[model samples]
Target: MSALRIALADDQALVRAGLRALLERQGVEIAFEADDGQALLDRLQDTPVDVVLSDIRMPGVDGIAALERLRERGDRTPVLLLTTFDDSELLLRATEAGAQGFLLKDAAPEDLHEAIVRVAGGDTLLQPVSTEPVRARYRYHADDAPRALFSEREVSVLRLMAGGYSNKEIARAMFLAEGTVKNYVSVILEKLDTRDRTRAVLKAITLRVI
Candidate 1:
């Protein structure tokens, strides 16, 4: 695969520098950098990248507000928030605001790289903190979730997908061939009526299907 290109936004110069260094070592190209949310938005208008890593709190428009604006304007690029470990409330807000995933500031370099890759690859949310706050909020009562419509094995595969397992990993865990796992993923997507794993998981959550 070609190198994954990424855009970064953070007010702290030191933090940005450290992250750039770390992410560079992880092999993704840093397309651009912005000091705040407004700046990030402006930069993104002209630059294209596979992912965006942004700080949740900033001087002007914060990360959640920026993500809201991005979705409002129809930008579907996956975004990962940078947060401190105790920012459960902010994390909850980020989830409600449609953030794809997030990274803890104190996470190891490999963990940070994995989070970015998962989000860019359209995987489900890999939350670093407790999702209790998020669960308590944003409870959707959609009747279209098709609860109990999944077969037992499909439910197992869906749970693994929600946990961000790749087809290869799921195949190994389930003692199935990788091709079989791919087939399962296709069926899961079809049953969920979603084109991607991320949306499928979100829909499942909205309907309490898994």
Candidate 2:
């Protein structure tokens, strides 16, 4: 199999170097490196990479802005956001901006590698603890008026998603086919005006739909 090509974008030189060395040791190719979002965008214009690993908070053109720009320009390369912030609002915004996965900066190297592979394969990855508090915060404020977009089934799926269940697991739990579950998720995303599952769940909670 061909090695996965990846780009590293972070303000810290040491962090970038360590991640590069670690991924290279695992046989993944480092396509390029950038210290900021703008530099990453410039490199992306010329290099064909499978994934981009970016720090959520950078000096200029932060990860969230870069993510929106990438998607706006129709770049399909998967982006995995590494953040030290576990704030639900930040996580929600990152998802809305189109991040494929979210990982804590302190996550194990193996977990990082696994997240990259999963995102490259078109799957969403979210740390469990990272998502729990966000979910709880939403559930705690359940008395607010409901958002007019999601259907009952979609809300159900989003609740399960906030619980960190995979699509297959959700299908099993809800007694629906996996495809049906995926469709519900897709519709939920559209209605919530968000990208990916994590943002959808966060938005649902913020909107008091779940």
Candidate 3:
């Protein structure tokens, strides 16, 4: 089989060098390297890699911003974000910005390799798929109105949305009427206080609601 071509983008030369060595040992080729998101984009104009591994923070144009620009330019290249910290808000932004996968810089080499391959094969590597962590993030004040809670079915709908299922597809999969699914989505948006389904899902993930 042909080797996987991967690109690295990070302000830290040491980090990129380590990742390059590690990935090369795994039978992957370094397609290119960039120090920031803008440089990555400029390079991508000519070089096409199977996947992009980028640091979440850089001097200019962070990973999330790069992913957004990629989307705006209709670039479907899969991107995996690397972070040095577990910042929930940044994670949410990355998801919303259309990152295919992400990992902490210190993630196991095996896991990192697997994540790159999986994302290249069209899978997302978001964490805490189970809801317990999400539930733990929920906090409410007694004086304030009870935080909006989605029903079991609504949460199911939101999960499908996160998986990129259309409303019609979600309705068919959930075995609910199309109109019912629409209503559920509307309710989900309201509960999450988001303007759209994408934001709703991202916000829900951030709030640990889904």
Candidate 4:
């Protein structure tokens, strides 16, 4: 396959320059660059790329707003959000806004590379950020909603799923047969009333269940 094409967006020119160099070193193509979320949206008017790598916070038309507008326009182009901020609420907002993936800006090169590939190839990612704070905040509101209680094991599986692990990896880590993991995942989906893993995990987050 040809190198993966990516559109880069950030307010800091230095950050964009550094990312361009790092991505090029990894055999990734920089299809274009943009200074902010609005620029990213404008570029998308014509340029087509495999993935969109963007910072969460910017002056005008921040990443979340950009993503919302993209989806609002019925554009499902895969978007992977990057940020230096450690705010869990922001992560929730980004994921809910239809970002295919979310990662800290300090993510290792190999990890970043993997995220781009996964998002480009049609996968959602949460990157294992500790959502404890967000969960704590969301719990207050979650209490008012009907809850889907999960077993201890099920919760473990959901966390790993949020980390973007496959069933085989989850089974290996949790020391269970792969089939058993599948059963757990099925139960999770049924409990969350989701038809798929991505929606299950997203719902789990929205409900503060994981």
> lDDT of all the models against the reference?
0.80, 0.80, 0.78, 0.84
Best by TM-score: 4
Q: Candidate 4 on 21-106: residue-level lDDT in tens?
A: 99999999999999999899999989989999998888999889999998899888899888654655676677778888887888
Per-residue lDDT tens digits for candidate 2, residues 1-210, read 899999999999999999999999988999999999999999999998999999888887998899899999999889998876554447766776788878888888888888788788887765433545665565434443333556678878887887557899799999999999999887777777667676666666656576
TM-score of each model, paired residue for residue: 0.71, 0.73, 0.67, 0.83
Q: Is candidate 1 or candidate 3 better by TM-score?
A: 1
Candidate 2 backbone collisions, by pair: none
**How does residue 98 of candidate 3 score in lDDT?**
83
Q: What is the lDDT of residue 207 in candidate 2?
A: 62
lDDT (Cα) of model 4 = 0.84
Tens-place lDDT per residue, model 3, 88-168, is: 446555776788766777789997898788778877665523334333454433433315777788888888877656678
Task: Quote the positional error of residue 80 for candidate 1 in Å.
Answer: 1.2
Q: Kindly list the per-residue Cα lDDT of model 1 for residues 1-210, writing each as its tens digit.
A: 998999999999999999999888879899999999999998999998999999888988988999999988889889998887566556545766778887778988888888888889886454465445444554555555553377888878877877778888889899999999899888888877778886676566555566
Give per-residue lDDT, candidate 3, residue 35: 97
Cα RMSD to the true fold for all candidates: 4.3, 4.9, 5.8, 3.0
